[model samples]
Target chain A: MQDARIRLFSFVSLSIATFLSVPGAVLSLGWLLLSPGTLRETMKSAAFWVILLFVTIIATATQMSGNDGLSYFIRTGVIILLGFSVYREWHPGEYLDLSVWLFGKKAGFDIGLAVEMSIQGLHEASREFARIRSALSLKGLQPGIRLIPAVGFLMIHTRLMRARDQADLLATRGYRAGGSCCPVFRTSNRDITMGILAILVVFLSFMPVRDIFILQM
Target chain B: MKLSLSAVEWNAGSWKFRADETFTPGVHLVSGRVGSGKTTLALLSARLLQPDAGAVEYEDIRSRTLSFQYPEYHITGSTLHEEAESYGVNPSAACARAGLAGRWDEDPFRLSRGELKLFQLSCLFMRQWDLLILDEPFSALDCRGKLAVCRSIGENRSGIVLVSTHEQHILPKTDYLWEMRTGKLTFRGPLPEAITAWESAPGPVRMLREQGVIPANLTRDDILEAVCRMHE
Candidate 1:
């Protein structure tokens, strides 16, 4: 969605609906399918597969323990899909614009700046991981189970160092919390449509399955 | 030992790179503008990346390595000692070689960028690789670090050393020249003769070529000698 506020609103509502019932998850899956390429793009990430594998293991364990694991699997998987779309659609300054538009200058700007920095940090960490892996391969070190701890340590250490550097830069620039910003948004009719649908889905999720079918008819 | 690219093609989204060249022993300086696929070429040459078509073949090249553009990317350890050991080099020896002696306990990230770069290069140069690909090795270095790198490149006598850089002034004596134009790797042939055909030649080299004098090599001394000869 072009409008960050609407996109976030839809995401939150859809996540809540998806978590409530199997029918809500089914509905959320339909919403996810509307994007078409989000699933494909999310699938391209190795991290996605790793997360899915972990979820699968937990779900399997739950099933073996006589719980409704299938429902849990569907809900979590759809939530992940929705989350990926939000991430993929995010522009650098969208959060700042939305926050400022919603909460005004001082408080919103500070919160928005923190969120922006955190998101950027995530991107930098991902890039760092790729470069570190390449470095390992160049050094004739193969990636296996044994190197996971070391790799994780390196990744976390670098991220913390980078965060510290960013903090220093902000301090040097005399930034003490709030900043001035003119918020702007370029929202489309489709964004509004999807947003309304998200709210409707939440309301429908709470209704009886028979009532939803009757209402549909 | 040799590294060869035969009709190799790699695609990254809309950008495409194609190369059909063979690199034999001695220093081959690959020069190109930024975003001209120099790093991609280095990675493909190092076999870190598989081409979408054709192949990159290594003939008798048992040991090989690729030095990344940013020195920070290669760091896997917290301290200088661990970093050296990560490269499988002795910590004290590598530290001393990089002029970081007695500072093995220092964090690798705490070192100045130039120091980190020198340290990384020093660790890599300690081993003899049949093929060594240095991608923008002089990027974060000072003049002294650049000279040290050039000196090390000069000392590698029996390997295919592919130095991909746009470094204009300081350079080791090179064997062949290649240029990456757009996304294609074009061979400019052996040096001296290749100097005339180097479309993206460095400023000094181009100036010397404009005066109808091609240096025997691309080193600082070679260009100065050529200039003196031009006056003579």
Candidate 2:
């Protein structure tokens, strides 16, 4: 996973497999769980459980039957796990390096810069959330429904200001929509093997494995 | 009351900060250039951020409030009335104090940035805090608003107040001074001593000192009085 290219390839392959086949998605979830500390970290987040519960409730409310609800829950859960696993492995900078390596420097740099900004935005959003929470605590107020609007407005305003500043900085630095970078990669043999395996898994997901197994029996 | 940092070390992104100093009761002005870890130190004093190494200890101080550089981040109410009343104060009085008296029913989000900052500052002043850490409180305020904030800090005689700002001019009467340089507490002592000791002291202070007009204190009024006396 050191090389962004192989890691991205594997992530794409797994995503395709998860979307195409239920069994393949389940298998991928199991594979992702093998990564050390993944399950522990995922479980520790209260937001993860709250989101999962919310999704389950919505699925149950909208589904035609019990089986449909169950299927929806499982599918969503697997996708979430897959996303978490991918995010855990990939650093934001790697996206830029990989893009520059794959495409011509100009187009690649633009895409990479976009990706970098998105990641930075997310980080700033989280930090802002913490600051808001602390502020509320200091004022002897708990974060309740009434506080949501204020929090949202503040977050948006700050984000807009930050975006404007970043734009100015980029302009001052003579950054165009496109720029060049020398892409370097440090992919190991294991990463290559994993990338190949991921592609094979995607291909296999398209086959009727249950039917094949039944026929052999 | 006293707030002390014992061999405190913290890292935020690429910046690393280390401090080992004690702060006594009164207005402590922490001045530094932008990105010199001033905000980091303020957060540390407020216990919003824990040091990677070392500790921050408070003596006879239980409650603390930290006002972020951006006042919008501290807003917790939907309307001006609600925000004004957030700190257990009379809504009408607080709104009047913040210069939003007639606009109480309006959403705080509808106000301009400077208005919102005034509202937040009004709420902050309403509460009794053992430690008050205001990071760049002067930003986004008009001259009148700035003067009001400085007066409020000067009047508050109960708690340990730490003001971290880049604005050397227009600060409240500071009892102690601390300077952050390159992620380190390069200077800490009485304000007058810091003014004399700080090699990169602000322009006005340096100019006065060069003219042999050392003020009795580091306040706008004190410095102005000294300069006027020198001219006379």
Candidate 3:
């Protein structure tokens, strides 16, 4: 579809997902409004409502709502839940982190926001480690595989996410319509790029980042 | 650094692949008839699909790489670069590799199928793997893109490159060949040995056998080139 439609659809769907996530949202929906889509689509998209119900429960059940940024907390919470719902419904079985709120606030940029959150997660991990390392030290844990993975998750999480998007964009460029690749490598610009890419590959191979920054989930 | 070790084991439906086939450290072409286990083989090697009763000896393969036939399957990020970064690839570089040289920050779910494939393909090739398994790597490639892929593999294709294809049109420079029938892996010696079989292959190979002037056995490319030459 058009870009506008796609963005609008995603935004509205995300917004509704956020609203529905509050504990009272579903109850409110039961007594309030319905989206324009068919009943099936609405039912399929119960994440927002679910989040609303959850928020209602948390607000009523606990005094946390009176803490701070209740609306902000709920908004960020809803967005995170909505993003998660989109991911769950889309791929069904893939594992990923809920990076929606890891980075404070994002205006509109998608990839940018994800990157920011990954870095934030890394920072948070560092803080968490410093805060809890002494406790673990007394427990006789030797800060081995666990320490590296805690930092690595954020890196792997962001990088692989970026790669997947690149794969999707190849489709828009009109590839594989009549099958892909030719037997012999045709000498062209991509070949030149292939050479440069070779150097980069060599660099990546020598790096020990795989052990340090890994995608655990 | 390496893929986890597991073997293929199964006794189900129309699919079958041998266990502990021992994928070597280079590109391998596993080809056979239509009913052969090409896609199933790729999945087995990549650890994306589990075998009936075998172990996948995946060694040292962290989550830096992603395995997906359909790009839609690998999408876990809310946006495009987010997806690439999830696989531990540079978002900008991944987008460029997928032919999305411009749309660096779009949602991965928003891109078309072809675009998604390119992005996934690049992300796949971006990292050095213990093994890179492709069922049909060239099923969705343009001439230039395919050539780029060929050259990329030629230069940087490290570890095991396990592939299965019937199309033969776009073939990798293979050192070994494995033929699967029913569920057994009919291990051929090398590409040359497989070429001998293809050259003298009974029903279909016979046609290209007569036309075989080139050394390569598979006629997908030669035949197409010949046909195009004849048309010209």
Candidate 4:
């Protein structure tokens, strides 16, 4: 049961981080691709794009091959919505108010476990970074630390450690800073179909449907 | 295209680095006080760490890779084999060379410090890079490891090796000896030339020489021979 609990959390967290990163990556690469260049310059620019496309192909192949296509989309939608919420509402601040809005402006910190874990992910990532930096400093090798590797190392340690200790937290039912709760996994074929239909609604909302409504008005 | 690094480079903190002469890569020893920017200077050359001032030039063609000191920092994969794969390093005999053959699938982070260092060292050795900036690779190694690194650094490998280390005990007979002092680095010629000049100096002036000025390559016996008249 303990092992199961850890695996569950690990799977959820890994899926969430991966899902969040896709669009972040896509947007970052999109701007890079939109560089001003001639036809020859564009071909040379295609080198970096090739690297991007290679990674995308790998990710897509894995996602499609896996049977959890709807779950993947749901995970992806949650991330995209969170990303937009950070960008649009805050405009420039970015995720500054996500913590406040995470609980939907009413309940305590642990409203839904996914929302709680999302915030904890950022906190854990930062805390692990500080811990690693402190540990390295104690060793006296005060070289400049690279951000990505430092974060990556700490992240792996943090997740693994949390995965192990998470079961104990559930047993105790204590409210820790890294508050634990069950993930809201609402999956149904009907919901998946509706989700796809919702996407189509938004897509169609941009075109003929709106024009037709305007003509009737 | 010979790019000479002039002036000093400082960033992020109070640390500063200065090079006395131009650097062409071969075997250049950057010796300095513990707090001085020996590592910073090395990182600068590697292009791993940027400088607020001063510039490292390629003259003609550009460099592609920058090696680091702590092998553990460079380990990116979950397992030893995966770590090797991350760098695209294919050791001829990975297991024997890195001593990680048996532990390929095991977590690299769980390995002992020495084992981790060896794994990283093997990966760097297998690669064909133009600039290898190793920041004190001798930190956690025995005498044999030091010799292996020195041999690799001093070899005719085409690219320049900028070794940022205070451990001068196990270095090969280097072509150039560089020292960092008071935010200024002086590039002394060869060990032979520096020892020769110091030997010819008067007793009082000779006493002024810090121990760092004379490297291990120029033994006292060699200096004494240079000082004394020994003609055939």
Candidate 1 clash pair list = none
Number of the predicted model whose lDDT against the real structure is largest: 1
Clashes (N, CA, C under 3 Å) per candidate: 0, 0, 84, 3
Question: Per-residue lDDT for A41-124 in model 1, tens only?
Answer: 777878777888888899999999999888889899888888877887888988988888778898999889988888888878
Docking class of 1: acceptable
User: Candidates' interface RMSDs, in order?
Assistant: 2.2, 1.6, 15.0, 8.8
* Candidate 4 local lDDT, B1-232, one digit each (tens): 2435655466543555665356664666666667666766765564545556766666653543444555555655577776667666663355457656677787877877677777776667676556666677777877777766666665634666666666735554466667766566666566546544432333422443433233235323443443443231
Name the candidate, 1 or 4, with the larger DockQ value.
Answer: 1
lDDT tens per residue, model 1, B1-232: 7788999999976899999999999999999999999999998998888899999999999989999887877877778998899889999999999999999999987888899999999999998989999999998899988998999998885899999998988988899999998899999999789999999988988888899888999988899999998887
lDDT values for all models:
0.89, 0.80, 0.52, 0.51
- CAPRI accuracy category, model 2: medium
lDDT of 2 by residue, A23-71 (tens): 6677667656555565666665566788788878978876855457666
TM-score of candidate 2 to 2 decimals: 0.75
Q: After superposition, how far is residue A114 of candidate 3 from its true place, in Å?
A: 40
How many pairs of residues collide in model 3? 84
> Model 2 Cα RMSD, Å?
5.0
